[model samples]
Target: MTVALMWEARAVEGRGADLLAWVRQQPLADEPLRRDVLRAPQDRVLVITWWDAPYDADLPELPEPDAELVTRAVHRWRFEALPEH
Candidate 1:
C-alpha cells in the first residue's frame, strides 16, 4: 500500500519565505517516493510526501518547526490510496 502524508502551516506575518526555507532544510527519517512543497496566498506552506508502507504502518513524519515561525499549530493528514477502478 501507499500512504500520502500532508503537512501544512501558515507563517507569521512576513515569515512565509523563512518558514518555507526552514521546512526545506528539515530532513525525513525515510526517503519518500515523491515530495511536493506548495505555497498559498496567506503565507501558508503545504508539504506532501508519498511513501511505500502498509495502510496501518507507523511512519516517520515531519516535525513541527519552532512555534514562533507560524501563526497557529501545524495541521497534518494521512491517506491511503485506493486501487484503481
Candidate 2:
C-alpha cells in the first residue's frame, strides 16, 4: 500500500509568499511518488506527498520553517491508500 503525508501551515500576516518559497526550497530525504502544493485564501499552505510505504512506516518529513514565517505550529497527517474494490 502507499501512504500519503499531508503537511499544512499558515503564514504570518503578509508572509505567505515567504512561507511558500521556503517550502518550495525544501529537500526531501526520500523522493515521493508524487507531490502537490496548495494554497488557501487565509494564507494557508498545504504540501501533500505520496510515498510507496505503509501508513505506519517511518518516513522523512519536511522540517518546520522558521517560526517567524508561520503563525502557528505546523500540522501533519498520514493516510494509506485503500485497495480498489
Candidate 3:
C-alpha cells in the first residue's frame, strides 16, 4: 500500500521566502519514496511525502516550525492511495 502525508502551514506576513527555505532545509529521519514542496499565495507552504506502508503504519512527518515563523499551527493529513481508474 501507498500512503501520502501532507503538511501545510502559513507563514507570518511577508515571510514566505523564509518559510519556504526553512521547509526545504528540514530532514526526515527516514527518506520517503517521494517528496514535494510547494507554495501558494498568502505565504502558504505545502509538503507532500509518499511512503510505502500500511495506512495505519507509523510514518515520519514534518514537525512544526518555530512559533515565530508561522501565523498559526500547521495542518496535516494522511491518505491512502487508490488504484487508477
Maximum-lDDT candidate = 3
lDDT minimum window of 10 residues, candidate 1: 54-63
lDDT of 3 by residue, 52-75 (tens): 999998998899999999999999
Stretches of model 2 off by over 4 angstroms after superposition: none
* Clash totals for all candidate models: 0, 0, 0
* Model 2 CA lDDT for position 83: 90
Q: Is candidate 2 or 3 superior in TM-score? A: 3
User: For each candidate, what TM-score against the reference?
Assistant: 0.94, 0.94, 0.98
lDDT of 1 by residue, 1-85 (tens): 8899999999998999999999899899889999999999999999999989986777878898899999889999999989999
Q: For model 2, how does the per-residue alpha-carbon lDDT over 1-85 read when each residue is reduced to its tens digit?
A: 8999999999998898988989999999889999899999778999999999977899989898889899999999999989989
Clashing pairs in 1: none
